[model samples]
Target: MARSKGQTALNRAQIVETGLRLLNEVGLDGLTLRRVAKELNVQAPALYWHVGNKQELLDEMATAMLREMSGGQGSDPPGSNWQELLAQAGRGLRRALLRYRDGAKVFAGTRLTDTGHAEEQEAHLRRLVAAGFSPDAAARASFIVFVFTEGFVIEQQAVHPMPGERAPGYDVTERAEALGPEFPLAAQAGADLFGDYDARFEEGLSAVIAGIGATLGPRTQS
Candidate 1:
């Protein structure tokens, strides 16, 4: 149903939600302002009030998606260890992103943004800094976690998607299989790719957490 002016007061949050829905249905390239407006039942011009343009809208959606993934973990306890807390936040964000189709792509470069994801990163940054990390180290460490999580998600999504009837196009798997025994590693992992993401994500995450922990200096005596 088309909304009246009284109901047309959609904010950026609503706009980003609409964008995410469109992305899931039509995907990135097929997504457009017209599509979003049609889904929202508003004129395209109305979106400009929230998103400015398509690139801005993409950036907004990316930020919004990452922010949505950042929650469900309760607040850090007072005086809790910082390394564990940081890993918790990173895993929370990655798990949230995994719930949606093509979620990683939707979240690219969001940490560098001032939008929703940046707000989440700021929270992580605060905890790290308070734990005696320098601002630069805090920033660098947060970024390492972000890159690993997002990169892992991207690979997982590409090499794996939900079981469904594939649409007509180049059969990617056919080409991959045709590469033959020369690509022994790829062939061996081919079947393994169908395994549980939760297991792999956790496995990868544990290593990341361990790596970060190894680099930490002993606590300073106040």
Candidate 2:
């Protein structure tokens, strides 16, 4: 039953929660102020009082989701090494994004400044700095991890085939036959590269972590 007028009030959290639900149901494109308001049994204008506009709402929703994910793994256990910690974070982030359809799309380039999760990000940067990276390098490394994960997941989700569609990536077999003797290596490489996406992601992620570690110099552990 709908609440009476006096009890029918909306707040920012409520609006954000409702928006997240809409995103999960219809994804980013289908989410709208009207749909959110309707879900809450309130007028569209009522939502405006809480969120400035759709972009603002999306930003808050993204922030909330990220905060929740980061909160669950706030710190590494005592005595854990930095590489292990960073790897765990990378995998955690990927798993969080995979929980919702288009999650990477929702998160790509959404800054977390002053959004309640800034401290968490800062702590990560500080951890890198303590491991001997220059302040500037630490910042760049932090950004790179997010960028790599976002880009990787965006491509992964985009290419995932829907029902009745062929699997993702190329059909190199037919192409190899068409090319005949002209491009044997290219066709074989295509087939090899596209086969195991999970392994591909792990290999890339390990490479990225190693590259970042190299930038920290010999002081990475001390």
Q: lDDT winner among the candidates? A: 2
Residue lDDT tens for model 2, 51-135: 8788888788778878778878767676665566566777778877766667888888665524576777777777767766788
lDDT of 1 by residue, 79-187 (tens): 7777677667667877766666667776775432455455656887888888877788777777778788888877766654323423343254665577687997776
lDDT, candidates in the order shown: 0.71, 0.73
- Model 1 spans with C-alpha error above 4 angstroms: 1-11, 77-80, 110-123, 129-132, 160-177, 216-222
Superposition error at 11 for model 1 (Å): 4.3
Best model per TM-score:
2
Give the Å shift of residue 51 in candidate 1: 1.8
**What TM-score would each prediction reach against the true structure?**
0.74, 0.78
Error of 2 at 45 (Å): 1.7
Measured with C-alpha atoms, the lDDT of residue 173 in candidate 2 is: 76
